[model samples]
Target chain A: MPTPLYLATAVAVSAAVTWGLRALPFAVLTPLRSSAVLRYLARQMPTGIMLILALYTLREVRPTAWADVVPTALALAAAIGLHLRTRNAVISVLGATALHVAMSTLWPA
Target chain B: MRGMRARGGARDFAAAAADTASVGLSLFPLGISFGVLVVHAGLTWWWATVFTAVIYAGSLEFLLLGLVASVTPLGQIAVTALLVNLRHVFYALSFPLSRVRPLGRVYATFALTDEAYAMTAGEHARSWSGARILWMQALCQGYWVGGATLGALAGSLIPITLHGLDFALTALFVVLTIDAWRTQRDLPAPLLAAASFALAALLTPGQVLPAAMALFTVSLLIRYALRHRAGSPAPDEHRHPVPAVPAVPAVAAAGGEG
Candidate 1:
């Protein structure tokens, strides 16, 4: 097997493990009747998680490739535009990704 | 208790479900891109696809690329992803997802994604049909499987350029944020999000996420504080009704069984 294949295997395994961890709360918590505290905590989770996810992704992008920021910004604009007009998630994400990709390919590095 | 939507028609509901499936389809590129990246880092497609289908969380999926490349132990990777996705717990609290057709815990948690969260978050605001929610998850997962598979195979066919992949997440967030802003009338949300993100960006170092989380936490706290002082409005109360907003109810009416 190639070196990439080894990495792929690790990734696949990691993904599985990660998914299992995520599913734990739902499996464990969903069945149980929740207390006020449980409910309160669950309510607070998304924004923090989402912020972490988005910021984490941005951190990896090289700061000097500031030009790359434009396509993503445009993609966000496209996603918002499509979503507002259509109220559809698939279209919004796809349109944004495609447009962003196209822009990246076209933009001078 | 809000049961199934009273006005949603079967056809519209199906259409909406189909629309959801497409969202998953979009995930295909992401998944495949991830798979290809992993393989390049030295893994196989099987492992890549499995992870894409199994782990399924977008941010964590990317993060896994780094962990795997560095030879991090599986246990360690698991622990980190769990911590990263810990925030999803909050999502299930208020949304209809916790009530989504119980998929034996594993499937429900495995399938959660930003798109999944966004879709279900909107659904929770309106009703609690576990079946509809499950349909969305299943469809999204399907796209993930297909996308990863194709991406792994095409890894060689496509040039090995990583040009625009990184920005995809930002675009996705921007899109979702805008969508949330337009649908609801509450100005506090976007305003708060902007203020928080900007401040977080300024204070954060090379890593923007923890900073963003700080901002998001502040926004949520602000909202939570407001709720305590003003009493939270009914979900529908925050919605801005366009004078002739037949579209809102029309979409819902055509989309439900009840």
Candidate 2:
């Protein structure tokens, strides 16, 4: 194992950098709170960010070919369908993940 | 503490825990994998808890697993953390930190993980109290830390080795995205996000998130400037959806969201 000092440094640097990024907007925007741009972003950014994040989450699913991408695409369709019908977060997430795992594992590539 | 005389106390903590249960379900498996990976990566079992408890970002922690094992330079590790987490800066824009009190605000900011951001900032949760926000954050960390610790300590015994389990988070965000759409019905915003990502992938494929976010932010700023020029009321404190949280008062509904 690496020394405790080394591990502590790793944790500290990662934590500091991560926390710094999270805190940046809050610090910068605090003074700019009165700015129209800031308010406009508050109205607008959340939805766009959430959409971007959803797409970000899908980054791992790269398309190699048309037919190769069927299962994962089906899983997304399943998730959206379940969510629209039920409006239950738990059901949609679990159902989609279950389909994804089963297809990815059982379906032949 | 004022109007909250009727429905209030530690109940907020419990309610937040319940609020976090769905996401907690996702975190547990991912966290358990992290725990298992930590021990398997030649780190001590306890480091699993240390990473989750301290660094707290999911993808970054996973990246750090490889980095720490390879003895990556500190500067490189810091850069990795910054790049991987740059998306967080955007989260602060709409996060209701202003409504949260001082000490709790600090904790809220510290724990502003993607899951935390989605949970608290979702349309239904706009009126969340400072205490509820804190408790939600604490509970989120608890689920992660707890799962990681369990996985590290008793990993092999758990008998779970599912592939594609990480997709749960993606699925969670998918649901949240749909919910955000249902809430606001903002078609252009989602289209803009897709276009931003598409453009980012076209240009800075390696740094899609930060690049897309920068482009998106600039676009939003342009929209704001145009709207301002068009005389749609300049954004002031009372008019804007204020992000400058007060340093004092208003925990009255601390436990009142029942």
Candidate 3:
């Protein structure tokens, strides 16, 4: 097969898998008519997914970049604060991003 | 929460559809980024657009870009993409969009991006509305389309380096995780994800995120299994009826969808 064909295949397969996984609750719940286990999982799904994603991102940071950590920590704090105070996703994200950019620029290593 | 209105009998499917459209439109930039990346990697813009329109999963899109560039074997790329996106299975499993009309259900499945999933699931907790769910999905797709177009048009116009942008996905995920943990009140979940990610990172360096995600997913499974073995009620036993799914019109959901 041509190389691009390989990528296309990858995209197709990935979409299928994604559909299957994401569709799991629907397929099962529609039949089962409300699964407590599944519901519980759903409740916590965001947290679990986010945690892994966040850690993965942080892990990529060079461990020695203490300066980077400062901005990151600031961003996290800003996000947390904005979320708690305004409970708004857009504002919190923007605020955190702005803070991080400012800090990084001001205190570049 | 000004006009937090609740309608009981007749379902406002049109309203929901409109809402979904707004979400998709807002998210077009995300899709555009993936589109730009795909074309930049030597693929045709049409293919890139088709993929964004079809696949519609952000992280997996980025991963697919890599798999495409390396010219990995078809079978291998397929498996990797499958594994990388395995978490989506869970996303689909518990989404409340299925509660919508069959047509809405079909559309929901097609439009179930991460943002939509988050919004819909949160809304479902309060009241299951086909309109609201549909709106979220549509909006998410909008973002995908917008993002792809922008990326394709201005692939090089934005001189900002792409080096740290990938981290945005990670940061976004982190924020998502934290929010999930805060809302879910389930200790095992956040802990499981963290532990799994840490272990996977140690085991696999470059592929840490995927490996960690897979491991984290397994951790959740194991926790579920252990709970099953013990025959104990899982934490989220009672569905707290959400109060009209407060439309926090502000929280501009961020992160490059791709």
Candidate 4:
């Protein structure tokens, strides 16, 4: 086990770095808020970033494996369908995740 | 005047609470899992609470438990934290922080996790108050901190059969992506996202998150340059005139669900 001082230092270091990243934009962007480039990026970046995040989350899934592929595909479809129908993020995420867990348990492939 | 102020405060609290309910619920299970992992990794329960309270960056905290267990160097830990969270820089580009008061903005920055970002990024975020935004973020953190504390105290006494709970994160992202897509109706962005994902997955399998984000940003800039040269109007040029909110600038900065 590490010493108490060492543990505390590690936590403090981690916190400082994490908080720095979070705070950087607010500090830097205030002045650049009116810049055309930042404005354009603000308009164009969200959908692309969200899409990238969704795909990135599934990056580890191996296409050759049916076990990983099938449930993810089903859950994604369920999420999209539920979201479109109800327009509620909570219901969509919960409903889809439930379906995914159920499939994983039952199939076990 | 005091009575009116009290009434407005109560209304803002209600709005923030209502907004946080779903996101908070989803975070609970993950926080419990994090706490359990901390104990299983030989850390004390309070350590779990401390990490949740201080770090507050959801997935990174999970990774931190492992780093802490191994007695990783502080410099390495800091670098890892930076890489894992570089995406938040992009989030700041659109996050609705300017609406928040200066004091609240400090806390809002600290609380700006992926889930908080996702909750606030939608079209509905246009009308939120600083109070509502800050409270929603605080409630989300409370769910995480409370769940982590509970799980730590319970330790291995809690059943270990909570399989597939992590998918909540993925499901959350999927829902947010759909919402963003519906709002923007921007085809090229999604396509670029797919292209970036493919590139990252193919080239740098282990570091997909940052790799994909960098590629996506590059792709977006290229697309912007091409469209500018072709004399095409920007996507939101005609349909959605910019909102009159002084704080809002060009679709706000890119905050996402962590």
Best by TM-score: 4
Better of 2 and 4 by lDDT: 4
Ten-residue region with minimum lDDT total, candidate 2 chain A:
A29-38
The segments of candidate 1 whose C-alpha lies over 4 angstroms from its true place after superposition are A1-56, A61-66, A82-92, B1-16, B73-76, B97-103, B123-128, B157-162, B198-211, B226-258
lDDT score at residue B214, model 1, on the 0-100 scale: 53
lDDT of 3: 0.60
Candidate scoring better on TM-score of 1 and 2: 2
The numbered model that scores best in lDDT is 4
Q: Which stretches of candidate 4 lie over 4 Å from their true place?
A: A2-4, A60-62, A106-109, B242-258
lDDT tens readout by residue for model 2, A1-109? 5677988999999999998888767766555555556656666666777778778777767689543377678878988999999988778888998888787777645
Per-residue alpha-carbon lDDT of candidate 3 for residues B4-28, written as tens digits (9 for 90 to 100):
4434222454555554453343244
Could you tell me every candidate's TM-score relative to the true structure?
Answer: 0.70, 0.84, 0.73, 0.89
lDDT of 2 at B126: 63
Expressed as tens digits, the lDDT of each residue in A1-109 for candidate 3 is 2365665666677777766656554554344324545445555567777677667556645667888777787777876777677755556555666676667667766
lDDT, candidate 2, B93-183, per-residue tens: 5677766766666677789998888776554576677788888889889989998898887755554455666677677778878876765
| Residue B159 shift from truth in candidate 2, angstroms | 8.0
Candidate with the greatest DockQ versus the true structure: 2
Going through the candidates in order, what is chain B's TM-score? 0.71, 0.80, 0.69, 0.89
Cα lDDT tens digits, model 4, B47-104, are 8899899889987887788888888988888888888788898767667776777667
lDDT digits (tens) for residues B101-159 of candidate 1:
34323465566666777665543335535556565677777777776777776775665
True contacts kept of 4: 0.60
